[model samples]
Target: MTGTQPFVLAEQALLGALLLEPSRIDSVRPHLRPHHMYRPAHAALYRALLDRPPDPGLTMADRTMALVRDAGAHAAGITPVYAHTLMAACPRPRHALVYARMIVEAADHRLVREHAVRLGQVAAADHARDGLADTLTHHRHLHRVLDDLHRRRPDHDTATSTPAVPTPELNPEPPLPGNLDDEQALIGALILDPAPMSALSRWLTPADFADTAHATLYRCVHALVLRGEPVDSLTLAWEAQHQGAFAAGDGGLTPELVAHIATSGMPADVDYRARRVLRAYVLRTAASAAAAVGTHAGDPTLSTSRLVTAARTALTPLDDALARRHNAITATKAPFTHTPPTTTATPWCTGVATWPTTGPDPTNPTAAHGPRSGRRP
Candidate 1:
């Protein structure tokens, strides 16, 4: 016996009930479809049952034999021996609806799991291509399937205590081999020219970096740019030191390495390189979300509603990244720079020019101009 044997028995019982009382097929038909059968042979038998209804003139034994013979035309391996086994398994044919409901619940669980597996496959493919559009399309399809399952679920569906979902047998396949290299390149490009940080910052975050050290350095660069401070190797190294990026235990980033990273990439490609890093983050997050959905779907103990809810929760991170990407793409321009409150002169300003509190007013030409000289506005 295997983990699936219980469902197999349930399938057998449902079939047995319908076999004993062919009239009950009408009652079960609304709730149980042929595809709901876990075994292909059983599904073939179901279709046979529907197609070769007992001739009113035939004896029950004759009808059973005829249906069993007919099912062989649709699927291989159907035999009279199994037909006898199914008939003997029926406890009471009158309760056929109950058995049908049982079969439907188990079948729905299997369907949900199969759908999750497909979604995971799509996400894995997207990861291979370093893209998210196809993954998002499949993600949406999975949700639609889940929603339809929720509506189809019998009202009596009771919540079972969710059994623990087994973790992936192996750690998620290590991230794409090129992810760290892309992170390094994006960081290097941004350090070489901070101008693109204005747009990149709107959608990209330090946490998106796949490498811990790269993330730290990106954060340093992001901060310097946000403050309107000049971003150079020296300024970044100083910020990194204060952030403890070069602590003894941390070996990935050193002062000399920071200088190298600052000059390692072409500044002109900063925006394009930054998008690559962001794409990697999205792909990784989508793959993780797909895995979580699969895990939840596999837990037979979870009700359809619970499974759907769990899947949505697992997908939240990917959804967030998608939303950010949409915002970045749709915005006409980056929002105005927001400098933190400081009593001292603005770090990037030459003298006592105070940063403006609001964005430029299109109607006021002067609103776009800062203090003209070394005087406060």
Candidate 2:
């Protein structure tokens, strides 16, 4: 049989079990809705089972026939012979609840997969529009779907192995040539004048760079800035070598290229270029998160709780970048102030508090209903 045929057989077994022992319908009734069945005819029959009760006076065979006859009115293909076949197909009528659970599990996977598809599509659209709003919306919706699935399968076993990393779908649109330029420009600007590193470091991370070599270079620059060390071509190259950014045969970060990055770009445009880099990172991270969620949904081994946990973990990077982006924007608008000398240290150091110091801000309307969530403002 094909992969999906087992679910069809599961629907058949469930219906047969219910027909054979109508009193046991109550066992599956609360959790297994008729619409959860894979086949339309099975769904119709299940609905009929719920609507019509077996005659109190009828024998076992007669009751089965009566149930089939009633269901035939609602479902086109259900006949007495089909009913007999279903009855025979069931391995044991006592295991009806197990069959019902199987059907529900398949239904949950289908629902999660469908939602993942929509999320991937939304992520693609948001990338095209250069918007984070829809990405956040679809992510929250997928989380809700996972939450509902968890409610449906509270006793699900979560001891499955870690889900393999999914091979992400290639984004149809190649990064604009200017995207790499923006990354280079941002680094160049920082190299030319390291002062902006204070403001830019609050949001831009090395991972934001499209090119690995550039990311390595950015990391070196950021490290030097934090250390209050001089940042010129020679010092930057030394930092790259110390961090092992250079692979022997790759000819990574040639001296001429380092000088080019150090000399070019206007320092004043660091914020603009940094925003562009952050934007690219958000879109890239969203696409990756969507793919991972889709893959998690498709894994049969994953229990509902595991699926939700895996999906949330996959989204953490994207969530952090978006939060930082929002905070960066907020920080820009607020007047810059000197860092106060405090006995207590905060997780992040910007002129303003990027994250909540005590707890989630109840006053912030967009804050997630949790303990100091990294939600967008």
Candidate 3:
């Protein structure tokens, strides 16, 4: 099947830009993978761009010829002149990164569309067999596949040069819906009264907040609480600025936002709001764990024991969090009491010794000594 035409154009433009200016390859290479290009020739050319060594002496034409020869474009009936054709077609060489992202997005869309068609066929077959449960499972699997494809991005470092492609057995985690309202309310409550920060810190983390701005604000407040500093609007704005949290643009935290949250009608019951946030987080975590277990359940390579262990590992954090909450409630209800010392003192040191009130005699050190000190012992 033919790939999307716009993506093909984008792929050509990116490759063309790289060929025209190899110096910009390092910046664009991290975001673009060979598989991101839909056409085989384009993918091969991108691979060659990544694989080629830095050679300042080589002219652009020589480099283009080398890339074409090394990529085996001759087999695809491509030539060195095609590189110049692409360069001439490209509108702006400086927008290579933008074109690279467009390619990735287009590739993702195509993958999702293809998978959806396949999933529809499977669902139809399963429905004919009267396997409703199996059909639902396949639907969930398809959703996870699409979700992984959308969320996965290249890492900053080249620990793994290749991006992980989603498969039936080794699918990435499904995206869960976070309660943004609860997250914002909890953060606002904290800004209103920093006292709840101590309790919230035990059960919540910045990761629990769905909004990036809220997470940044929570992190700042948590740090201030740890350092015994005030967590008012001004301090939070300062901390956010210092941490570069507000530089993200658009939805980033701002001083006015901080002040508004602080002055808003925050929940009088801060603990209740905190628990709501924690509940949302726990539910989201449980759903993710269940999805992960379901995805790996059918893998033949994973032993039954390994699958069980994986499920346990995924669910253990939620279990531990609930256990801690229960323990905290139990402790709060119990009375406080001072316990006596458990250890006994030695008999030889039970009695106290008297000391002389006078200062030590410098003229005779022995004169200041006690009766048992100077003569015999």
Candidate 3 structure quality by residue, lDDT tens digits, 191-298: 766655654565566655556777788877766554444556777787777667778642567888888876773756666556655555444444444445455443
Model 2's alpha-carbon lDDT is 0.71
Model 3 worst lDDT run, 10 consecutive residues: 340-349
On TM-score, the candidate that comes out on top is: 1
- Candidate 2 per-residue lDDT over residues 122-222, each given as its tens digit: 77787777676777787788878877776757765534554544444444334556678888888887776665665566677776777777787877776
Where does candidate 1 clash, by residue pair? Answer: none
Candidate 1 local lDDT, 143-197, one digit each (tens): 7887787777744434464543344432443567688778888887776655556
What lDDT is reached at residue 303 by model 3? 32
lDDT top scorer: 2
Flag regions of model 3 displaced more than 4 Å: 1-178, 248-251, 265-267, 327-377
User: What's model 3's TM-score?
Assistant: 0.41
Give the higher-TM-score candidate: 1 or 3. 1
> For model 3, what is the C-alpha lDDT against the true structure?
0.59
Clashes of 3: 0
Ranking by lDDT: 2, 1, 3
Better of 1 and 2 by lDDT: 2
